[model samples]
Target chain A: MVIINGEEQNAAGLTVAEVLARGDYNAARVAVEKNGLLVPKREFGGAVVSDGDVLEIVAFFGGG
Target chain B: MIPAKEEMLAALKERIGGDLLEKFQSSAAAVCGLGGLGSNIAVSLARAGVGRLFLYDFDDVDVTNLNRQQYKASQIGMSKADALRENLLEIAPYTEIISQKVKITEDNALPLLKDADVICEAFDKAESKAMLCNLVLEKLPEKYLVAASGLSGLGTGNSILTRRVSERFYICGDGESDVDTCGTLFAPRVCLCASHQALAALRILAGLYDV
Candidate 1:
């Protein structure tokens, strides 16, 4: 199992795109980092999530 | 020797003294984007005697900012941070002002925010504001950040609201207005938003909220 946003998930073999699709959020609005390395938006479909990986995702909205 | 909290509290009581003043005297704040909203917020904080202020702005004062900004026409062409510092000093000569005339980016964000007890995000651009907020939230989750949005025009008074979006994040101003529709801001609305931002900062510094 892997953690997506601190929740334990069974989708360890899923790609970043799959995870975003499951969450119903656009990949462009978020910046994802896997273990401190930024996963570019273009590579979301190709980048795969593995077990014991720490992921941090940030979403942007209207702000000052 | 460091004065007792009670003694400091008493001195502050002569003015804004109380639990809020006590908390404010010990707090350090960083304000980014010294435009209309940011300038007003800095002035309010200085008047309230916030212990230290870290002011950041890369732009020079322009003719358009005079309508709502706390700055004057004479300040045109001067660095916004410098002008704000001068104005704030007139209100609270004892308070410390750390002025930085530079654009905030990932590389310098930590350096500018290292000692800030609270960060006030007052940048105008959506992309820059979002980037800074995301960086601060991701890298410094424990730090409190108050941001503003939707303060673009003169509209219904009820449009303004100060909301706590998360434990460490808060936002103020109307969410419906934008720069496109609002044209330029008037004094009343900008001041209202600035007051809300100041109140939020005061509350956060006094530990009124868990965040």
Candidate 2:
């Protein structure tokens, strides 16, 4: 079980795009980093999420 | 025996001194929104003895605002700026308040922020937040603006994040979550962000923190 936003997520063999689609988040405004490595938005569909992976997604609002 | 403003000044003589207090009292800050975050920030600055607080919020307090906003149920139909001014005076009667019950647009942004040494951008909507940010950055080149974003949710640990965005600007709060997702905010988080903002204002006023 992987944790998406601290919630236990069932991502046994799912890609990052599938995970985000399941979570109902916009990929455009969010930056996904896995284990401190930046995951490009274009690769989300192909990038596979592994177990015990520490992922941080940062979203930006309209700000200065 | 009684610590009036003068005596309070005398007591803080060694720590802050009369000269600094005088400067603090003469300096002005404009808070652009009187919503949840703005309300808390305004009250905290007023209590901290910031000389003049120019508050702007076009909306009247609705019943929905009682959840996390600083106003009471009795103030539901009142203008947010007026209600905030009244609330702030309860804590420090001598703190001067300038209530502007109007929205911050490009036309009026300069006038409202012209004399402001520090500006607290507390607008909730992203469009308004961006508008104010650009307005202050482009129009008021010298003023220090502390803008808040990403303050949402229930956890205290995730509620406060302060970063200096530019030479004259600082950003505080979670940086991701929003009011729509988190619903109403708790005082703990709001206070944390407000305290951070007030500290930034103080440092700017004291010439300790230059952007």
Best-matching candidate per TM-score? 1
> CA lDDT, every prediction?
0.77, 0.75
**lDDT minimum window of 10 residues, candidate 1 chain B:** B1-10
lDDT of 2 by residue, A2-50 (tens): 7664566778578878877877766654555565455666688998888
lDDT string, candidate 1, B71-104, tens digits: 8899999999899988887767678899989999
Worst 10 contiguous positions by lDDT, candidate 2 chain B: B1-10
DockQ of 2: 0.09
Q: What interface RMSD does candidate 1 have? A: 5.1
List residue ranges in candidate 2 displaced over 4 A: A1-64, B1-16
Distance from true location, Cα of A61 in model 2, Å: 3.9
Two-chain DockQ for each candidate model: 0.15, 0.09
- What are the runs in model 1 whose C-alpha is more than 4 Å off? A1-64, B1-12
Per-residue lDDT for B1-211 in model 2, tens only?
3347776555555567777777788889999888877888888777666789999999999987776678999998999989998888777777889998998898878988898899998877766776676567666768988877776566665557776654677777778767676665666766677677777887778776753
